[model samples]
Target: MNKKRIPLPWTNVYGLARTLVALGTAGTLAASSAETLFRPVATIGDYPSCNSTTAASLFCLSPDDYSHLTWLKWLCVAALLVIASGWRPRITALPHAYINYSVFSGIAIADGGDQIALILSTLFVLPALGDRRRWHWEQPQEQTPETRATRLLALIGISGLITLRLQMVVVYLQAAVAKLPHAEWQDGTAMWYWGSNLDFGPAPWLDTVVGPVITSALGVALMTWLPLVIEGSLVVSPLLPQWLRWWAMGAGLLFHLSIALMMGLWSFALAMAGGIMVLCLPLGSTIRLRADEDVATVDTSPSQEAEPPDPDRSAPSVEQPQPSR
Candidate 1:
């Protein structure tokens, strides 16, 4: 096929995606930790950690020690703020990633959202480090050695983003796959059981309001099959139409929103939504090289010809004065 392929603004696309994931991580971290500030370890007891004498090597201080850990938590919060502000990401990104890692390693109980934030925070920093250029939204450029080098670096950054994006798709697909062996999912009655369970279901008042509708056979089937199909379809996003891809991503966003509202899995929902932001990126522009025939046609076109001068509109040329010897 003699199809002409256009170049994409990979660096800028990575930059835009990184900005969103960073900001989303920041928000998730802040929201998740907000309650901890009001209810300190002193009041709620220490977070379970492996801080015994033998495990002392794992962490410097006792797991319960709030002295340094509290300060570290605040530091992470500050770093996240700086990153979200779009201040020099090269500097702040490392610290933000480190803090997120520390939250999981230093603490005993880390939410699934923490893992999501940590993964994104770490991956984004690589692109930020490699990207020495500013983000731009402008006309595509002609290829040059310098442009090629820039694109190469951009490819490196984009590779990481692509890895993360594909990883999310795999995770969702795996979840659906795993459920295939379960009778509830196969029978389309899983949502009914989930909604009926008091421990994991909606609150008492909410259950009373929405219980009957959600627990019905049709409701259960719809809820179960919709997510399975939606998540499974994401794997083939590139093959889908552009508008359909967007709609899929948007549906994923709403799915997470519903999870947060009904299931109270806010962190997981936000984290998943953050990853979907990558798929939601607008298509980058590609440079379309003109064919030789098109170029020749353009060159010969009437628009390329100079207009004939009008005698009345033309200015008279001045005669040169001759110098006498």
Candidate 2:
């Protein structure tokens, strides 16, 4: 009797999501200077908290001097680069979580993206810890027998992913539902106000292109209500079929991209894009594993081959001579 094969719950299904999260946080830090990210004044306040004896961040582990801080920031970037490259996930997972936590807790100015990255990176550590592959993108070999311990670890990792998915659903649901009470969102004037803002508004060049449309009443209604519709759909995306989930993912990404373009929230867009992939993508179903494909080929080969003819079964037997009988 063949032993049942136990599927490892942790696999390359979330590889892209991990990479995107790492890149988003890394890009934000790499693009900014130490001075901009860790203001001298803010550092004074946050340093003690971040550098506490128990929960010290890499940033807070050292002196808050500009040169040292700069070096630390770059080191964090290097670690994130490793994570983004999908290498040695078991080694890099905790470091990735630590880096995001440092950025969120130690930075002078942070956004929603930073918080999301922190949450996701931490959650990803569970899956990464359970995965035995050197690279996060690697699939397990076919017919690999999982030990009880490994199976438990994989289940724990999968639980973390499920929690992450539920968190994403709540995030979008709250965003859409919370906006319902706002007068501007209700009246459809929110987009116009946001578009016309000086600090976070679209660049002058972009404004020139979208100005006419945003200024129109119809455009305002669409812009304001469209996000609510998209966000609501994303909230229920887990229950949606694969195709609809994909559509929701596309719409969510587009929505975030528009914010990035208009409000210069590139990090936010990247972080949310990763979340969308986690929320919408069906686990273990996105990429076909080479081992599985090989198995499939092997399974079909026998059917394709013409069976050898059974001489006695396929051919009529000659009648035996009956004269002696």
Single out the weakest 10-residue window by summed lDDT for candidate 1: 297-306
lDDT of 2 by residue, 1-325 (tens): 4333323444555777888899899999899998888774532564324645425667777675878988998998998889999898888889888888888888878889999999988898877777777887765543445578766776677678789999899899899989999999999989998888899889998998778878999998899999999999999988775557757888999999999999988888888888787787544323442355346321100001012212222111112111111
* All-Cα superposition RMSD per candidate: 15.0, 12.5
Q: lDDT of all predictions, in order shown?
A: 0.56, 0.74
Clashing residue pair totals per candidate (backbone < 3 A): 0, 0
The numbered model that scores best in TM-score is 2
The per-residue C-alpha lDDT of model 2 at residue 250 equals 87
Write down the lDDT that model 2 would get.
0.74
Q: How far is candidate 1 from the true structure (C-alpha RMSD, Å)?
A: 15.0
Model 1 score (lDDT): 0.56
Clashing pairs in 2: none
